[model samples]
Target: MSRWSSSLWIPIVAVAILIGSILTGGRADSDPQGRPVVVYAHPPCPPDLMRYFEEAFADFRQSHPEINLQVLHITGNYEDKIKVMFAGKVAPDVIFMYPTALPAWVELGALRPLNDLLGTNVADYFAAGVRT
Candidate 1:
C-alpha cells in the first residue's frame, strides 16, 4: 500500500498488548531523502515475543512494499524515553503504548484518530475481535 490504509493497521499491530496501540506523531509521510518511512518503536521484550513482532512486520512488508517500516527497540525507562523522543519532536510513526498511558499521550497531542479512516465502529471491532 502506498499509504496507511485502515485495513493495514490491524495486521501491523498484532504483535501483542505491550505493543498495544499505535501512536503516530512524526515522519509518516515521505522522509527527507524522499522515501516513505514508518518507524515502529517499542520497549525491549523476550526473544520469542520479539520474534512474533518481526513475523508480523514481515507480513506487513510483503503486503505494503512501498512503505519502509523500521522497528526501534528502546531499552530502559520506556515511557520516559518516549517522552524525550516526543520532546525532540522526533516521535516514531508507530509507538508501543499502554492503554492507560494513552490518556497522557492524548493530552500531549501525540495520537491521531483513525476512526474515520477505519470506517468501522469501535463496538463492532471489539465484538468481533473478542470472539476470535
Candidate 2:
C-alpha cells in the first residue's frame, strides 16, 4: 500500500474498535439475544473517505461478531442536526465531531470524560490535541 493509505489505517482501526470498546463497557452484550447494538454517527464525508470508513466498519463487524454495528452518516447541516438531536435528548453511542464543534459540545456536557475508562488508550490512538 502507498504511504498515504497506510497512514489512514491506524485511525480507522482505532475508530472501528472504539465503537465497541467505549460503549459496551465489559459486558459486550446488551440484549438477551447476546448482541449489543453499537451506533456510530459521523458527519458526511467525501465518497472516498466514507468508503474507507465503511470498509473499516465492515472489518470491525466481522471481527466483533458479538456486536451489531450501525453507521449513521448524517448528511447536510450536520451541526444543526446534531444540536436538534441533543435537544430531543437523543444521541448516538459514538459521535464524531470536528475540532471547532468540540468546545460547544463539551460546554453542553454532551460528552463525558473518558479518562477513567480509556486511560492512555486515547492518547495511543488519537492525537495529543484530541485528548484535551
Candidate 3:
C-alpha cells in the first residue's frame, strides 16, 4: 500500500489497541485484593501487645486469605505522624491509641466517631484502665 496508507493504518491500529485494552480493563496486578491494609500502633506498645496483634492478624489471614494486614509502629511523635498524614492526604485505616490522646483526636476530627457503631452509653466504658 502507499506510504500515507501505511502510516494511517499504524495510528488506527494503535488507537484500536488502546481502546480495546481500556475496554478489557487493561493490565492489572494479578491480585485483586490490592494493597495491604495498614494499622498503626503507638510506638513502645510493649512487645507482648505487638505480638498479640500480629498473631490475631495471622489468624484472620488464615480465614480470609485475600486481605493482607500491615502493622506500623509510631516510634516517635505520634501526633506528628497523624498531622503529616492528614496534610499529605494519606491516613492510616486504623490506629491503636492510648486513652490520653483520644480527646485530642476527637477534637481534631481525626478519629471516626464510633458512637453510631458502639451505640449509646459509651460512658459505661471502664472508669479507668491501663490504656484509658
Candidate 4:
C-alpha cells in the first residue's frame, strides 16, 4: 500500500464511528435504522485489506444496524469526483480525503466545521492531524 493509504486506514474507521454517532445520536434506540450515511473514499484496497475494511463495517453494523452505510471507492480523480458530488448535491456524509484538499473544500462551503462535534477532546488528536 502507498504511504497515504496506510496512514488513512485508521482514520477512515474513526470517521465511520463518528458517522454512526452522528446518525444515531449516540443512541442505539434512537430509531436510526434505515438512515443512510454515504461515505466516499479513494483507491479501493487489495483483497486482504478490503476484507478487513468490510469486517470493520460489519462490526459497526452489528452495534448500529439502524444506520445504513454506503461506501464508494473512487479510483479516478478524487477531487473532480468530489466537486461533481457537491455540485450535484449528493456529497457523501463522510469523505476520506487528503488533508491538502480541506482548505479548498472549506472555501467552497462544501465542508462543515467539526469543532462542535470534537469539543474539548480536541487534544486527543495529534497536532499535525488536527492541522488539516
Q: Which residue pairs of candidate 2 clash?
A: none
Alpha carbon lDDT at 40, candidate 2: 81
Query: Over the stretch 1-132, how does candidate 1's per-residue lDDT look in tens digits?
Result: 646697777776675422433334434567666669988898989998899988999999899888888889998899899887778677787899777787799899888775565565556676643332
Ranking of models by lDDT: 2, 1, 4, 3
Better of 2 and 4 by TM-score: 2
Candidate achieving the largest lDDT:
2
What is candidate 4's lDDT per residue for 1-132, written digit by digit as tens?
698898998899999986776665533322355475645454556778788878887888788766766667776777788787677555676787677777888888988767678888888988876775
Off by over 4 Å in 1: 1-28, 31-35, 120-124, 127-132
Q: Give the per-residue lDDT digits (tens) of candidate 2, residues 1-132.
A: 699999999999998776655455523335666688787888988998888888899999899989988777899998788777666555677888887888899888888776777766674656775548
Return model 3's CA RMSD, one decimal: 11.1
Better of 1 and 3 by lDDT: 1
Of 3 and 4, the candidate ahead on lDDT is 4
Query: Comparing 2 and 3 by TM-score, which wins?
Result: 2
Model 4 is weakest, by summed lDDT over 10 consecutive residues, at 25-34
Query: lDDT of each prediction vs. the true structure?
Result: 0.76, 0.77, 0.65, 0.71
Q: Candidate 1: RMSD over Cα atoms?
A: 15.8
Off by over 4 Å in 2: 1-32, 119-131
